[model samples]
Target: MHEMAIAEGVLDIALDYAKQNDAKCIREIGLLIGDMSGVVVDSLTFSFDMIAKGTLAEGAEIKVKHVPLVGRCTKCGKDFRIEHYDFWCPECKDGVLKIVSGREMQVEYLEVD
Candidate 1:
């Protein structure tokens, strides 16, 4: 699964940062995952736990903030959450919605000790 790869990447980042900062252990990892990113939170977490067993990041808490798909209407200047892949503006049907957020997966922060 791609989640395994993603988890590996995350662990690498955490470990690299901890090593650079002279941290003995990693406490937490903050992640921002968009709805359209297609990353499964549970699978990612499980994969991370499995791979982190012998690392400094073992038992580290993974804090995830789910980001919803948001779009802005070009004609109506309305910003709204896009549901079911709908691209039409709710207020102005003539305007097409442009993606404002979502489709992202990134590590926001890491707590180390």
Candidate 2:
């Protein structure tokens, strides 16, 4: 699964940061995951846990914040949350909805000691 690769990336970042900071342990990691990012949180967490063993990031808490997909109407200039993949503007039936956010997957913060 692609989640494994993503986990590896996360671990690499954590380790690199810890080394740079001279931290002996990594306590937590905060992530911002979007609805359109296509990352399964459970799978990603599991993969991270599996790979973090015996490392500075071992036993670290992975905190995830969910970001909803928001879109803007191309014609009416209205912004709204897109539910169920609907791409039509509610204010104007003729307006097409363009994505404004919710396509991101990134590490936000790290807690280390």
Candidate 3:
């Protein structure tokens, strides 16, 4: 799955950072997941658990932070967070919307010991 690749990339970055910092082990990994990023949280976690064995992140805690889908209405100057995939403007009920956020998945912070 794509999550496996994403997890591997994240682990690679974390491992490199840990080694550069001379960390003995990783305590936790803080990840920010956007709603539109298409990265399944559960899949990512499963992949992480599977690949983390024998690595510096073994047994490390994973903190996933979900980012809301924030969008700006094209018809009206309104910004809102949407839980559903409907991109319609809440106020105007228009289908035109400009996504402001919720399209990113990145490692925000890493806790190492």
When sorted by lDDT, best at the front, the candidate numbers are 1, 2, 3
In order, the Cα lDDT scores of the candidates are 0.95, 0.95, 0.91
Question: Candidate 1, TM-score vs. the true structure?
Answer: 0.91
lDDT of 2 at 13: 97
Candidate 3 least-lDDT 10 residues: 81-90
* lDDT digits (tens) for residues 12-94 of candidate 3: 98999999999999999999999889999989989998999999999888899989889999888799997768778889898
Instruction: Give the number of the best model, judged by TM-score.
Output: 2
Off by more than 4 A, model 3: none
Clashes of 1: 0
Candidate 1 lDDT by residue in tens digits, 64-95 = 99899999999989999999988889897879
CA RMSD (A), model 2: 1.1
Instruction: Give the residue spans of candidate 1 off by over 4 A.
Output: none
**Rank list by TM-score:** 2, 1, 3
What local lDDT score does residue 105 receive in model 2, on the 0 to 100 scale? Answer: 87
Residue pairs in collision within model 3: none
Please give the distance, in angstroms, between residue 78's alpha carbon in candidate 2 and its true position after superposition: 1.8
lDDT of 2: 0.95
Which whole-number lDDT from 0 to 100 does residue 112 have in model 3? 97
lDDT of 2 by residue, 1-113 (tens): 98999999999999999999999999999999999999999999999999999999999999999999999999989999999988888888768778888998899999999
